[model samples]
Target: MDYFATVLISSLSSASILLIATLGLAVVFGLMGVINLAHGEFIMMGAYSALTATQLGIPFILAIPVAVLVTMVFGALVEIIIIRRLYGRLFDTMLATWGLSLALYQGAVLIFGSVSPGIGMPQINFNVGDYTLAAYPIFMILVAAVMLAGIYALLTRTVYGMKARAAIQVPDMARAIGIDSARTNTLTFAIGCGLAGFAGAILLPIVPATPSMGFAFVIKAFLTVVIAGPVTLAGSALAAIGVGTGASVVASFMTSVAGDLFFFILTVVLLRLYPLGVSAKWRIKL
Candidate 1:
């Protein structure tokens, strides 16, 4: 019973982490229909921004918003300059963002060197039956829950959310209704990047800031979003939990490589089964 409880909690924590990392990409790809290949670099930028803030004597908690603001502003600029021209052009957007990712990666390497220091994990622990567990990981479950709720509320209850959905779904109608689709899109993109920033800052203790750190997360994040389909937020939550927990459980009994293998195999099977994605036929508004 103790072992089972331990595995369950650990697996949930892993799922929460994956959800946190993938939320931004899901928003960008699912709603905007823009495949942001530079999504990972935005996350890396957030990590570095938070790291720099902490180094400059800002409290770690406060550094989170700082990172978010930095990334949002940068994201807005990118949307205006590059993304604006590439909307609805799938391959072009991908190629442009891919180039942007390379540039950001190289810039990070130049500025921070090949590697950077990692923030120490907060020393919080608790007893789970006979097994010891880190409270931080459990805290992530709460964070994921809160983040998910916040995003849902933001998208469902707010005027901005209405506009964003309108702009994405029917741009001509949105414009006819006196909505500034261009501005809304830029803000939406910025918000997505800000969410990515939040993930980096929040996960800093577990995953360090590095020039190459984005590469470690980007692929998995993309897969989670792709598997999510049209219902970006809720679908991503489901996919992340399912895949992340399953892989974590496998790793507990076997090896980390095996866990990755399970993740890929599961993804392939899920894709084959639901070519349009698991939630493609869902009747929800999100």
Candidate 2:
């Protein structure tokens, strides 16, 4: 029973971390229909921003918003300059963003060097039936839950949410209704990048800030969003929980390689079963 409980809590913690990492991509690729290859770089940028702020004597907690703001502003500029022209051109957007990603990666390498220092993880731990567990991972579960709820509320209840949805779903109608679709789209994109920034900032203690760090996360993040299908947020949550928890559980009992194998195999089966995505047929707004 103790072993089982330990595995369960650890698995849930892994799932929560995955969920947090994937949320920004869900908003961007899922809602905006933009395949932002640079998404991972945005996350890297956030991590570096927070790290720099902390090094400059800013409290770690307060640095999170600073990272978000930096990324959001940069995202808006990218949308205005590059993404705006590439809308509806799938391959073009991918190529452009890919180039942007390379640029950002190289820039990071130049500025921060290949390897940079990592922030210390808060030393908080608890006993779980004789098995010690870090409190921060458990805290991630709550953070994931709150982030999910906050995003849902933001996109469903707010006027901005309604406008953003309208702009994405029916741009013609949205424009006809006197809504500035272009402006809404830019804001939506910025918000997505901001969310990515938030993820980097929050996960800094665990993941660290490195030039190549984005590569470690971007693929998995993209897969989670892709498997989420049409209902980006909810579907992503479900996918993260299913895949992340399953992998973590397997890793706890076996080798980490086995866990990765399970993750890939499960992803293949899911894609084969739901070609359009698990939430493709869901009759929901978000």
Give the alpha carbon lDDT tens digit for every residue of 210-284 in model 1: 988888888999889888888889899999999999999999999989999999999999999988888999999
Evaluated against the true structure, the overall lDDT of model 2 is 0.92
lDDT of 2 at 100: 98
Candidate 1 regions exceeding 4 Å error are: none
Cα deviation of 258, candidate 2, in Å? 1.7
Q: For model 1, which pairs clash?
A: none
Candidate 2: deviation at residue 166, Å? 0.1
Q: What is the lDDT of residue 146 in candidate 1?
A: 96
51-75 in candidate 2: lDDT tens per residue? Answer: 9999999999999999999999999
Q: What is candidate 2's TM-score against the reference?
A: 0.98
Q: Report the alpha-carbon TM-score of model 1 versus the true structure.
A: 0.98
Model 1: lDDT to the true structure? 0.92
